[model samples]
Target: MPRPAIHQSCTKIVATVGPACDTPEQLAELIKAGVDVFRINTAHGKIADHEKKLKAIRAASEQVGSPAGVLLDLAGPKIRLGELKSEPLQLDIGAELTFIREGEPANDFEVTATYPKLIDELQPGNTVMLADGMVALVVESVSTDRATCRVTASGEVRSRQGINLPGVKLSVSSMQRNDIANAMWAAENGIDFISLSFVRSDEDVYSLKNVLKAHDCDAFVIAKIEKPEALEHLEEIVDAADGIMVARGDLGVEIDVAETPMAQKRIIQVCKEKVKPVIVATQMLESMHHNSTPTRAEASDVANAILDGADACMLSGETAVGDHPIKAVEVMSRIMRVTERNLIHEINHSVSHCVHPITTAVTNAAISIAEAIDASMIIIATRSGGTAWVKSKSRSSIPTLGVSDCPATLRRIQLFWGIRPVGIEKMASPAEIRAKISQWGKENGQLKKGDRIVFVTGSGVVEKAHNAVVVHSVE
Candidate 1:
């Protein structure tokens, strides 16, 4: 068995792998740089490439003693111009552009749009965005085979530009053929997570869930809230996903650039409040893509993500193809640590504690006992955030963990202050809980074996109460 990762009081760093860091030595450098998880983007690499890198990453992890997690980001629902007629088409200003059907081929410029209905579905005067929202097109006429759109808003258009039809709003599913392949591969590989892209509704999550269930995959699903359709139905996505990712790259493309900041904050808040771990990603360190240092605004962006209750801040191009992959992690880690230390979760969740009579009584008793004993820590076995909030509201100056059988709970509790969250199965019995607590305590130096610790639980009918207390020795 390998050694475990070092203890960081709060927050984590997730690094993306790319051209710059594909080898074992480069990968080991990232892991050594305090990367909590490694992301393999299926969007760019072949399955063989990912397989080689995944093997290297895992081997490195085992060699180092403590293995980190691997996050396989599926190339979900990408709408791209397929097989361009030319590498660099002369997309002149005021010229008309048509998104051709899937089977069409041309010489100058022809986009084999995946959505066969896009041409027919779009109405005259609908706005079409391309190249990560850099270029804008307005539909002048619509036909079954083509939509005559002019470059009313001018910007550079490149080969394989991602086209977005905001007004057309054709019904598209998040699960694509490529996504199915990547997801299936990820599941069989013991990947810790599968990042769902272009998620629009709760049903999308449910649909992906069926695929995951079919493979008996225990991997957690992370919904990337980028589509405008997804924002309208955010709650349903939250309930379905184990966690969420604030994928700002495409999100900024979908919504106004000015609205990106506020929208990111909202997504983070909603995900956190649900006790799910939220990851704030995209351009977090874009400057690092070329230069080693990030701009002041970028620094603030990172700090704000941490303040917004994000459990992790992810690096995309920065660590993937940046001038300094290791430096990027170091800087991000420092920023997160500094920001977290200065900031606090102002929202008090204690007000929502409504419980049945017996559970309420047991909860009150636990709070009283926790306070009276001046305990070093308070632990709660709660599937819901209620039990944790009870202790939080009492203003207990102690570390609290919302222990849960659900991984979603662990991700969710990352937003609350002074709380360490983890996904663990039920302790089975009071004795088992005590035994595990004792082991964790001694190993972490929180308590010694002989030390007396007070344990609290809820009444039988309560949400997360056991109606008992036990004194155990850490051995």
Candidate 2:
């Protein structure tokens, strides 16, 4: 019998690439440490550098015999201040500054902000937090390239620090020039997924999808929900997008810190309820950036996200340029393995019977068959994730095999709850499919003669018509 490639415990790790871990060899090390996905943040690196990293990751993946997915994160519609004599602008509590739509200096102490639509959204008394919320200013008046803002509170704003203006949703969409460029790059590079930063609504998802379609890229579009405006239309966004990312970094900046934990939990539930992969990102292992070890609280946070049904957790600064990059991934993988052990050894596992009627019906049948026969395992032959999705939505408390003809199916299915994808493809015949199932069982130690196993799959190649559950005995 053979072992499963990807087993239960619904936690996956995504590592960001940067100056810290850029080489092919280093990426191979991260992949070895169970980093399921790799992200290329175009916000920091050049396109050529990203292309080089993509090639490096591909070579390493080939060397390791597993296709690791690459995610390109776009620079969202970022409104940034113009150049300062020295950034980290020091201001008194009552100082005033000018924020403009143009990209130039306004005066000796004032500077233009560079987003064409910034002034359009500015309003009197509108609160704008500067440099990741280190400072706050209230809008007094506005013009095309300039706005008068009185310092509501003052603090240092360093170079390229993030600015957040909540309660003033921009009139324009969220896609930025960099995002357009990144989406084009994603299409050209054959990236698996494109994560849109600072997505504010379902319209943003549609806008990006339209762009991807224009470029003829079938890559999945994942909306990065990091704004309050994005939260308002979350349900629609979930429906429009293939996946959702709980981007806590900017989300926290835009919303109160005290509300963030509850918001995170809520978004996780929403994505789960929607049957889309939800990625919990930003500072999962922030301490790993500087230290060799993770805080107990951070480890617990990761575990909690897993229990909350987060399909994947992402590492930003930790993997991007952390001092202990590989170590960070290793730590996270260890955490996932132990957390899964805890679930299997103590907690009961139930398969999902997803929301769709057909999936629910097939899932119920699978569970009934499993219970009546007391089967040890179930085999699900799937493409496009529907078959496995049926098993996932079923809530069956047994080891399920997600066999797929496409490797992307295998990798993408990694985020599904209670699914372990075993890559196998045969276009021969039904007999061949059955033989491969048995062969897999025998090779993986899951199938033995007289053991009853439930097989879930569609009879033909009608991708979405996943409505068959065949019970068979291994012989």
Candidate 3:
């Protein structure tokens, strides 16, 4: 048997593209180190910068011969401090300050708020957190365009820093002009996924989908659940989007920090039940931003996310601006491989049975048959990648090889948990698919003599129905 084309791992890694890994060589190294998805944050860069990075990523992915996915993360209605009198304002405990609407210059004791309705939404006694909750403030009074706040915790506040108003629902459009433009750009550029940040409700997901449809872009949308209001309608939001990302940075500030862990678990559980991918993101490898190695606690956090059944773990500043971008991916991959080895059995048992759809039943059966026979591998031939995705949800110990004729489908499936996607020529029949899988498996060393393989594929000319499951032995 020959060696597999790509390294196989169960948990996916999402690395953000930024100055640290902007060049083609760096991007290629990151991909080789095990970055399944490249995320482009629209908030920080201009369109020209993003286009350059996207081109580099595609070139690097091609050089590596693995279809790496690109995710466009939009900046939703995120409220922030507009500007400071100086770079940073030092506030003492119990100091009084005023927050005025944008376009108004702040005095020494005042700061500008980005959202116009911030004052209207917040009332006396509402808590305001800045700089990821390092500094805290309590609203003492409010006027039409400004609010008086008393500093509860003293810290330095910088320009454009995020402001989190706990329990306050601001009347802002979920999809801003910039977000719509970014979505359109991503759709036109063949981005694999779009993450809508600060998603407050299911309606926000629907609204983004409508915008994408208008632009003729079918990129998968991942709802970033960071706002407190999202918890009330979490089920609807999960059902509305293709996936959910637990954006814990802002969430920790918006809600009690102690509640974030439970919230993360609940979000993952909901996504698991709906058969949609869930990404646990924000600060997983934060210390790696400056250091070449991550702390033990950070490694434990990544492992815990995998144990919690998250489909993927994301790195923000770690890979985007960290000194060790490639090393970060390597470390994350190593951690995932180690954790999956220990938790494979539990993972296989934890998957809930899918009873409704015929395809679901067929996919589940494929896993069951493979596990019972201790098959060497499960071969999934799919056109839209739906069959492979459903089969991956079972989390069988046996490796899953997803074969697709479409490069885009292969790239998109790279984000699916426990799937090693390979691109192949279009097959004419199930017999041809089996022969191809056999040849590929043998050449890739995925199968040797006497190794049993579970072959799974869908029926119908369009590949809509998963009606076939065959067990074959390598000759």
Candidate 4:
């Protein structure tokens, strides 16, 4: 079956692949609905399972011809409760519960935690949150093998639910042994991006980079800023990483929920200044997981992310296990379109002054010329896609058409805001490159007769170095 064309939405959408959208046909639907990237979460499935899904996603993306990217999320040092005697245990307010280090058959009041160093890392009066902060506990006493806690805010606590310690720093490496194996697998399999979870410092980013380099993988590293410590070393971490994800779920649990909005804005602003792609994730359309339609507040939340200049917005459980995954993506796309329409004034006011080299100035000047002349698109022929990335940071109203011969570069630019990646055969000269752009623009229906296009390209003699910009009319 032929897939329908999706509108060119500026803010990219990332959908997680799970039981709901695991098959190639289902993934095709997501691609048709405008998903820019498919995220494979290593925390839920085995490597073999993910390998199959990655194959399906690639096939589906090729069929749709969208060049959708794949992001492999590595499960970092996460703590969870062990098996329970029953499915869920209910605790009343002011009840006492003990968490043991060893796994055992649990009664109503006691359960096992997976992290063996939980007791040693935590002290009395420390707050423990369970089940995504639904249930809260205050520690009263600690023993060699167990920590007894009083339930401050009680609810149903399920087995294998995640545990969050607000201020306690656990003595664990950012990447576990299994995470390294998963990352190696992702690199060997040609994954476009790798998301490191629970990133604390710049050292964590360097460690993952070293692993990728050792494996000879070119996948971009995205640091998940979920811990408060990451906020303290934000600049260093951002400099070390290729991108950043505002993982609001764990961050909200670690800090006051009210502070997350300010933190998100700050992170996005800093990433824009650094020219790094930023993705706003977690609970954007949570209500649509079961319901067919999203609440008005959910729509506003997604729009606000786009308005705040995030490169992408992600859907976790909404696309992973939701009943209306396609509808969710459609809703998000519509909201992005509406929000982008209102951003022209702001984008014009906030011009990027990233004039480090001559190429940066040329890129900025090209965008300025495009915006002033109301050009249909800004066309860039890049070997490494660096010119397209610089134009995307300007946040121009015009869409960027990035032409590249490198498949990896095409896939990597799919995550950039307002950039449409098109793969082309290698051209030998400047005239050949211009002719190819015009041919692609006509075939893709992005340009019509007499339409103006701001074209930028690197020197034909040098690879991956931009030095030329011109405005051409489609013939």
Measured by TM-score, the strongest candidate is: 4
Model 3 C-alpha lDDT per residue in residues 1-475, reported as the tens digit of each score = 1122346468899999998999888998988788889999988978888899999999988778778899999989888888688777888899998988656564778788778778878899999998999999999999887899999999998999988888887789888899988888888888899999988889999999998898887788999999988988999999889889999999999899999999999998888777888999999999999998999999999999999888899999998888899888899999998898877542232232322266667878888888899998888877777777787777666888877777778878878888888776665566776777778777767678788889887544234444789899888
lDDT of 3 at 121: 88
Per model, how many backbone clashes are there?
A: 10, 18, 2, 0
Per-candidate TM-scores read: 0.77, 0.85, 0.94, 0.95
Candidates sorted by lDDT, best first: 4, 3, 2, 1
State residue 473's C-alpha deviation in candidate 3, in Å: 1.8
> Judged by TM-score relative to the true structure, which candidate is superior, 1 or 4?
4
Model 4 Cα lDDT, one tens digit per residue, 256-347: 99999999999998887777899999999999999988999999999999989899999999999999999999889888988998875332
Residue lDDT tens for model 2, 232-254: 88888988898888999888888
- Looking at model 2, residue 236 earns an lDDT score of 89
Q: Is candidate 2 or candidate 4 better by TM-score?
A: 4
Residue 154, model 3, lDDT: 94
By TM-score, how accurate is candidate 1? 0.77
Off by over 4 Å in 2: 1-4, 7-9, 100-108, 140-145, 150-154, 340-360, 367-376, 393-397, 426-453, 459-467, 471-475
Give all candidates' CA lDDT scores.
Answer: 0.70, 0.75, 0.84, 0.85
Residue 425 CA displacement from its true place in model 1, Å: 16
* Model 1 misplaced stretches (Cα beyond 4 Å): 1-9, 90-92, 102-109, 345-475
lDDT (Cα) of model 4: 0.85
